[model samples]
Target: MPERRPTRSLPETLRTLRALRTPADPGFWRSPVRGARFTAVLGVVLLVGLTLLFVTGLLSYAAYNPDLNPVNDKTPGKGWLGFYLFSWPTGPHWLYRLTQGLHVTVGIVLVPVLLAKLWSVIPRLFALPPARSVGHALERLSLLLLIGGALFQFVTGLLNIQLDYLFPGSFYTLHFYGAWVFLAGFVTHTVLKTPQAVRVLRQGIPRGEGGTRRGESGTPRGESGPPRRGTDTLAAPDPLPATLSRRGALAMVGAGSLLLLITSAGRSFDGPLRRIALLTPRGGTDPGPGPNAFQVNKTASAVRITPADTGENWRLTVRGPAGELRFSRAELLAMEQHSAELPIACVEGWSTSDQRWRGVRLADLAALAGYPDRPPGVFVESLQRGGSFRKAALRDNQVRDGRSLLALEVNGAPLSPDHGYPARIIVPAAPGVLNTKWVETLTFGEL
Candidate 1:
C-alpha cells in the first residue's frame, strides 16, 4: 500500500484552535495599545501607592517613639502590621519601615516605565490641539505645568540617585518645592478631564457592518485588529462635516491624555524619591542615616577637626548670661564624658540609624558654660566661619530633654569632619537645620 497521506486540513485545524481561544485565554495574550496603557496605568498606580506610603510613613515615623514597647513581657504573636494595628508595638516604626520599603521597591520599577511611557506618549505632545485666546492659553498652561512638573520629578529623581557628585545641594531645595507644583497640575488635570471621561464611558464602544472602525485605530473602543506595530495607523476621516461635536475619536485621545496627566500628577512620586529622594545619592554633606549611626567620641581631640588643613583652627567658646565661657579643644576634651544611643531625624524626612553617640550632655556643658537656671539661647559656629551659625533658643523644655548631647563621637568612632568633628549637637527628632555642627561658640541668652 502507498504510504498513508497525512489527512490534516491545516486551515481547519488552525481555525479550530483559534476558535477555542478567547480574550480570557491563558496563553500568549496580545493587545498593544491596551498593553501600553495598562503598563502606563500600572506605573501611575505604583507611583501613587509609593506617595501614599511615604506621606503616611513620614507622619507615623515622626510621631513614633520606640521606648514605649514593653520589653519585659511576651506579647501574643502577630506580624509587624498586627503590632502596628494593636498594642503599643513600637508606634508606627514598623508601618513606616514597610511602607518605605514598598516606596523604594516601586521606585525601582518606575525607572523603566518612566522611559517607556515618555517614549510612547511624546509624539502626542507636539501634536496638541490649537487653543483659542487667553482661556485656552491658561488651559494649555496648566497642561504644560503638569507636564513640566512631571518631567522635573522624573529627571531630578533619577539624577539624585546617580549624579550626587555633580549637584549636591540642588536636590535638597528643588525636590521639596517641586512636589507642590506637581500636585497643583495633577488637581487641575483631573478636574478638567472628569466630564470627558464620564462621557466616553457612557457612550461605550461603537461597532458596525464589516468589522467597521469605531473611535480610532488601535484604541480599546476605537479599532481592533492584529495589534498594530510602532505607530497605530490613524483612522479614516469622518464623512460628516467637521462640527465642534466632541463625539469622535479625537475626543478619546484628548480624554486619555488628560487622564494620563491627572493620574501621573496624583501618584507618580509615591515611590522611593518621596521617601528619601530616590535618585539622590547617599553619603554627602548631609547624607541621611538612621538612629543606629550614633556613637561616642573616642579620639583624643586635642582638637577634633577634620579636613585638617583648611587654615582654620578649632575653637570652642561659650557665652551666656552667667558670662562668656570659652574653651580651647583641650578644655572641651577635659570635661566629663558620657555615651548614649540616640536617633537623629531630619526635616527632609530621613534619619540616622539607632546611633550610639558619646559626648557630654548639653545640660552638663551648659552648666560648664554657667548658664542661668534657664538661659535664653545658644549658638553653634562652624570652623569655616563666614556667617555659618546655628542659633538655637534653649527653652526650659529643651534643657530638660535629656536626649540632647554635645556629640563628639558617632557610630563608635571619633566624629568625622564631614560629620562635624570636635563636637556637634545631636538632638533627637530635630531636622538637619537644627542639628548644629562644628560647634565653635555657645552663646546663651537672646540667641
Candidate 2:
C-alpha cells in the first residue's frame, strides 16, 4: 500500500543526521530560568530528598532483622560516621511507621525534582567532542551511574507500591545493592562538580553563551583554546524556557509533593487523613471484614488455611527462658485482656487504619511462660508456613515493650480467618508481615 519511497544509503543517512544536529545553540530560545540558579535550586531539593530516602531505606532494610547493624547499630542514636547503627527505636513504639512512611513518601514526591535536574543538564551528553579529557570521562561515568541507578530505584519502587512485579530477581536484594551503587556514584559526581556549581551560582545565572557553563579555560566558557591540564568543563544547563518561572517551578514541585504526601501518606497516618487519601489502594477496596475492616495481605485460602480448622483447632504457645506454655482461645480470652488502637503498615506502602485490637500483651505471655526479658530476642512462629515473613524475631526492646500484643479480637469481633483467626501478633511499628499473622509459638532466647 506504500508509495515506493527509496531509503537513503547508510553514509547519506549519517550525514543527514549530523547536519540536522547542527541547529542553533540553545541560548537563543531559552528563558533566563534555564540557568545555573534554577539547576542549583533543583539540585539542592534533590539532595535533601536523596538523603532522606537513603536513610529511611537503610532503616527499613535493617528492620527485617532486628539484630543486624542497620537495625541495631547507627546514628541519630549515636555518631558512628553518621550511619544508622542503633537498634531501630523501640521506645516510641511507632518508629518503623515513621521511617518507612517517610521513605516512600519522599521517593514519590522527589520525582518532579529528579526530572527537572535531569532536564537541566542532559545536553552535556551531546556536546561536541564528547569527552575533553580523561577526568571528564570519569565524571561522565559517575554521572551515568547516578542517573541510571536513581531512575531504576524510582521505577521499581513505584511498581512495588502497586504490588506489581514485572522484573526478575528479588526486589529487596536488587534495591539494596542498587542503593549502595547509587550512593557511590552520587558522592563521586558531587565531589567532581561542586566547585563549578558554586562558581556559576555566584556569577548569577543565564551566563553569556548558549547553555555554556563555567568550565576549564579554552572551552566556550573562559579562554577558548586548549583546556588546562587540571581542570574540566562545567555541565551545561538545559534550554527549557521558564514558562514556569524559577519560583513557579519550585512551587509546582512543592505542591505536587504535598499533594502526593497527603494522598499516599494515608498509608501511614491512619487518622482523619484516611478519608481524604482517595488514591490509596486500601481505601476503596473491601478488606471483606476485620479490624476497622482491615485489608488482608495474605488470605486464608491463599495460604491454604481453612476457616473451620482455624476456629476449632487453634492453640497459642509461648516458649521462653522459663518454659513452654500453651492455651486455647477461651483460655486466652479469659485472661487479663487489654485493647489498643494500632495500624497495620506494609512494606508495599499500604497500611490499615487504627484497628481496635483486643488481646494479651506479649510481656504477659512471656511472664506466663516464666521468662523475663533479656538480650538477643524471641522467635515468633506462625501456623501457616512457606511465606517469607511467616516467622520473625522480636528483639529485647520489642518483647519488653508493653505495646506488643498477641491479639484475639478486633472491633469487638473475634478475628476473621482472613485476618489471622484465633491469634496474631500485633506489634507497635513492625511491618505488617513481621507481626506474624496466625501466630503459633513464641520461642525466647533466639538470635
Candidate 3:
C-alpha cells in the first residue's frame, strides 16, 4: 500500500509565496560625518581635475583653428593629464586623441559617484520651504541650474556616443557652449557650498543635530518626555533600505568590476590598440594600383577630371591669379618633401587609423609658385569638372600651420588613382571638405 502525502491549499501556497516575495522600500544614504569630508574632498579633486581639462581643451581647439586665434598657434600641450580634454577637431595627433579618450573614460567613473552623492544629499532639498526669501530662492535656483546643466551634459554626451541620431552639429555646438555654462554653475556651487561644508568640517557637526534651525521658538519650554532608547532612537530612516542597499551594493560591485574590465578593455580596445585591433576596414579596402593605372602621357588636351571617375592620367594643374600656370609630374616631385601619419576625421563622426602622407608642403609649393615673399590664399580644384573647387584662403595666421600638406602617397606607397592618384592635398587636421582629393588645379587668390 502507498502512503499519501499531505498537500496545502493553492491559496495558502500563493499567500506564502507572496509574503516571501515582498520588497522593501529604498531610502537615501546618510553617510557618517567623517564620510562627508572624504566624499567632499574626492569630489572636489575630481571636479577640479575635470575643469582643468575643459579649460585646456578650449585652448587646444583655439590653437588648432588659427583663424580663431590669429596671433598664436602654440598652446601648452595638455601633457600627461591630457586625457581629460574632450573637445573636438581631434585629428591625426597622438596627444589630442589621448586626451579625448581619457575624458570619456574617466567620466564613466565620475558618473556614478556624482549620482550617489546627489542621492545622499537629496533630503536637504526639502529642508526649507521654496521661495521663502530672496537668498533662498536664488540658492535653490542656482542648485537647480547647476544640477540641470550637469545632467544635461552627462546625458547628452553619453547619448551622442551611443546613439548616432543627434541633430547634426547640435552636440558639438552644445558641448562647446555648455562647457562655459557648466563652468560658471560649477564655480558658483563650489563657492556657495564652501562655507557651510567647511563649517561642518571645522565644528565636527553631530549627526542630524547641528546646522541652522528651521523655525525657532520664542521662549524656553519644559521637558516634553523621556528620551527614546536603543539604536532605534538614533537610527536613521534607513537612508538606503535593505533591498536597495543590497541591490545598489551589488550594482556598485558590478560597475566597479565592469570599470576594471573597461580599463583593461580600454588598454586593448581604446586609442591605437582598439582602433587597430577591433575595427575592420569597410567599403573600399583595396584602392587598386598607383597613379599610373590610367596613363595620360599622350593626351595633349587636359581631360576634365570628375569625381565620378578616378582614372589614371589624372594630372593636377596649378594656375596663379596673374595667369601663371604650371603642370607636369616632375615639377611637383622636385618640390620639398613632407610627411605625417594622421587620421582622416570625418564630420560624420567616425575616425580611422593614422594615414601616412608623402608630398610637397603647400607652403613650400606656394613659395615656389611666387608667394614665398608674401602670404596668399590658394584654390584647390578636383579633377571632376562639375564639382565645386575646394578653395582655402590661407591667411597670415594659417600660413605657418604645419597641418597643411599636399599628400602624394599613403602608407609609404604612391597615391592610388581612386585616392586622388598623382597628388592630393592632405590637410592634416582639417575636416573632410578641406582634404581635397583628385586635385586638378591650384589657383592663387589675393583675398
Candidate whose lDDT is highest:
2
In order, the Cα lDDT scores of the candidates are 0.46, 0.69, 0.49
* Residue-level lDDT tens digits of model 1 in 1-447: 899877669998897788674423322232223222333343455356436633543343323221223211122222242234322122232333344334433444454544544443443344324444566567668867676876676566556545442434545346545545666776675555433333334443222222223433322232222343322222111123434332333344445544433333222132232333323323222234442233211222323344653223666777665677666655666778777665544322333445677777777767666763553334555553432123433333344356667788776777766567777776654434445667667665543
Provide the lowest-lDDT 10-residue window in model 1.
65-74
lDDT of candidate 3 over 134-201, digit per residue (tens): 76677678777677777766776666645454644556556655666676778777775555455445
Q: Sort by lDDT, best first: what order?
A: 2, 3, 1
What is candidate 1's TM-score against the reference? 0.51
In candidate 1, how many Å is residue 378 off?
Answer: 3.0
**lDDT tens per residue, model 2, 348-443:** 766765688899988888777766444346688788856666677777677777777889998898888778888988887777777877888887
Clashing pairs in 2: 72-86, 72-87, 73-84, 73-85, 73-86, 74-84, 74-85, 74-86, 218-224, 218-225
1 or 3, which is superior by TM-score? 3
Q: Of models 2 and 3, which has the larger TM-score? A: 2
Show the lowest summed lDDT stretch of 10 residues, model 2: 69-78
Which whole-number lDDT from 0 to 100 does residue 77 have in model 2? 31
